[model samples]
Target: MELWFTGTNAGMPIADRNVTSIVLRLAETRGEFWMFDCGEATQHRLLRTPLRITRLEKLFVTHLHGDHVFGIPGLLSSRSSLGATAPLQIYGPSGIRELIDSWMGITETHLGYPLSVCENTEGIVFEDGDYSVRCAKLDHRIECYGYRVEEKPRAGALLVDRLERAGIPPGPLYGQLKSGLDVELKDGRIIRSADVRGPAIPGRIVAVLGDTRPCAGAVRLSERADVLVHEATFGGNLADKAELYGHSTAEQAALTAREAGVSRLLLTHFSSRYGAEDIAELVQEARTLHPNTDAAVELTPYAIARARNES
Candidate 1:
């Protein structure tokens, strides 16, 4: 899996960073990608990357802020113009339905594909065989939220060498053994799958939070996550201003990651006031608490590798 940042600024777009929009690309999900927070000009930002509008399967809106949702209509309209026939799903807080309805109804925009809008999004918002997504209400100016995406654990690899050692030639029996079943060979020997399978591969956890201050909801969603994408809207020196604006400073975000026991911290949603040098300094401040912290750059794809330990 990888995270591609389309926009990384806090409230508004600057010359370098745009507002908040992120893409989650999973290798096991065919060519589909899930989007979070489509800010203004998000479609234009996607054009700069290799992500296809047709492959956008779902959108998770964090809040109703203009900086987080102004691009929804444009993105939906452009998807239709680009010939995307696949259905799309959107999940967000209570007023999201009215917001979308007003936009589509006022513009008279007709989409060729079916669009499902899910409002009052919380608890287990989405779940399938492969993954589950849970949302928690966060502390923001409005009713914002944070999402936790967890991948299901996969079966262990079949130990072909051990199977060969047991004189079991490769055949349909291999499939049964891989499925954790006991297979009887032609010689009447019972082969236990447990004896020939490696350890189970643990699933990955990714937490993506919207604009918020340090709160328990953020920690709950980010607890033990492989990657925690939190907003660092200001520098450590601006902690007071950050709290007043319902945003987190870089230092505060890092402390949250540490408290959550997350494996990695990705700080994004930076203020436009910070230049490149200032952003680097903010990252450094975060590193004092969480050594694995990094500033998420726009249009950059951050790969999430599997953890070495199963825990």
Candidate 2:
């Protein structure tokens, strides 16, 4: 899996960065990418990267903040114009559906694809065989949320050599064995799949949070995740100011990742007052607590490698 930072600035746009937006590009995409947030001019940001709005299957809005959702209408319309016929599912806090409904209604924007808006609360909002998504309320000015994506564990690799050594040919019998069924051989012997297969491979976990301060919800949502994408909107020296504004400093974000025992911490949503040079200080502060930490750069794809134990 790869994480693409489309926007990483806080409050306003900087010369090099836009507001808060992150796209979770699955390496094994079933024809869709999951977007964490769509900030203002996010479609324009996608134009700079290899990502496309048409390929986005789901949009998870952290809050109704303009910097987090102002691009919804534009992105939707652009996808329609691009001849995307797939349905789009949007999940967010209450009033999100109404907000988009009003925006589209006022602008008289027409869309060809079907849109499904879901106002989410704390719990497992989405689940399927491949993945499950859960959300939790976070400390912010409004009803903000954090999401956790957990991929399902996969069956172990079939032991082709072991089966061949046992005089089992690779045919329909291999299929039955792979499906965890015992295959009866012509010699009146039974072969078990589990006896020959390797250990099951653990799935990956990803946590993505919107604008929020250091809180338990953040830790709960990000616990032991392979990648924890937390907003670090202030510098270490500005801890008091960050709390007053319901934001977290880079150091605090690092602390959260450490407490959650996450493998990697990606700090983003930096205040616009800081320039590119200032980001070094933020990242350094985070590294003081969590060594596996990095400040996210806009349009860069950060690869999420599987944890050692998971592998």
Candidate 3:
């Protein structure tokens, strides 16, 4: 899996950063991409990367902030013009359907494919054969939410050496054994798949949070995650201002990551006040508190290798 940052600003666009948008790229599947928080000018960010807009399968909105969702209508319209025919599904908190309907209705924009909008509260929001996404309410100005995506565990690989030692040669029987099926040999003996298979590999977990303050929900959503993507709208010196604005600071994000026991911390949603050079100081401050903390940048993509022993 990988994470691509389309935007990483706090409230508005800065000279260096945009707003708040990200993409989750699944390595196991071809042409599959899921998005979180499509902020304004998101399409412009995609232009700089190799990502295909038509491959976007799902969009998860965290709140109703204009900086977070103003690009939706334009992106959706452009997808149709680009000859995309696949259906699109959007999941978010309440009022999402009304907002999209109002915009589409007012503009009289028609889509070539079906669009499914779901406004939900705390529970399993999305699930497919390989991934499952869950959400929880966050402490923000509005009814914001945090998402936890967990990929399903993969099957073990066939131990070719063990099979060869057992007098099994490479052939169609290898395929059957890999599929966890029993194979009957010409000698009237049956070999079970478990006898030559390694242990099943656990999947990786990624937690993404919207605009919110440091609260229990953040820790709960990020518990034991392989990567925790949280918003750090201010520095530690501005804790009061961050709390007043219903946002988190770099120190707060680091504390949450340490408390949640996450393996890595990715901090974004930076205020426009900080320049590119200043981001290093912010990252260093966070790392001082939590050793695994790092800041995100626009158009940067992070590839996460599959867990060890994965099939």
RMSD of each: 1.5, 1.4, 1.5
lDDT tens readout by residue for model 1, 1-311: 99999999988999998999999998754788999999999999999898999889999999999999999999999999999999999999989999999999999999989999998456999999888999999999999989999988877899999988888888999999888899887788889989899998988899999999999999999999999999999998898999999999999999999999999999999988999999999999999999999999899899998865863
**How do all models score by TM-score?**
0.96, 0.96, 0.96
Which 10-residue window of candidate 2 scores lowest in summed lDDT? 302-311
Candidate 2: the clashing residue pairs are: none
**Strongest candidate by lDDT:** 1
lDDT for residue 253 in candidate 2, whole number 0-100: 95
lDDT of model 3, residue 92: 93
lDDT of 3: 0.90
lDDT winner between candidates 1 and 3: 1
TM-score of 3: 0.96
| Separate clash counts for every candidate | 0, 0, 0
List per-prediction Cα lDDT, in the order shown. Answer: 0.92, 0.90, 0.90
Could you tell me which residue pairs clash in candidate 3?
A: none
Per-residue lDDT of model 3, residues 213-303, tens digit only: 9999999999988899999888888899999999998988999999999888999999888887777888998998889888986788887
Q: After superposing candidate 1, which stretches have Cα over 4 Å from the reference?
A: none
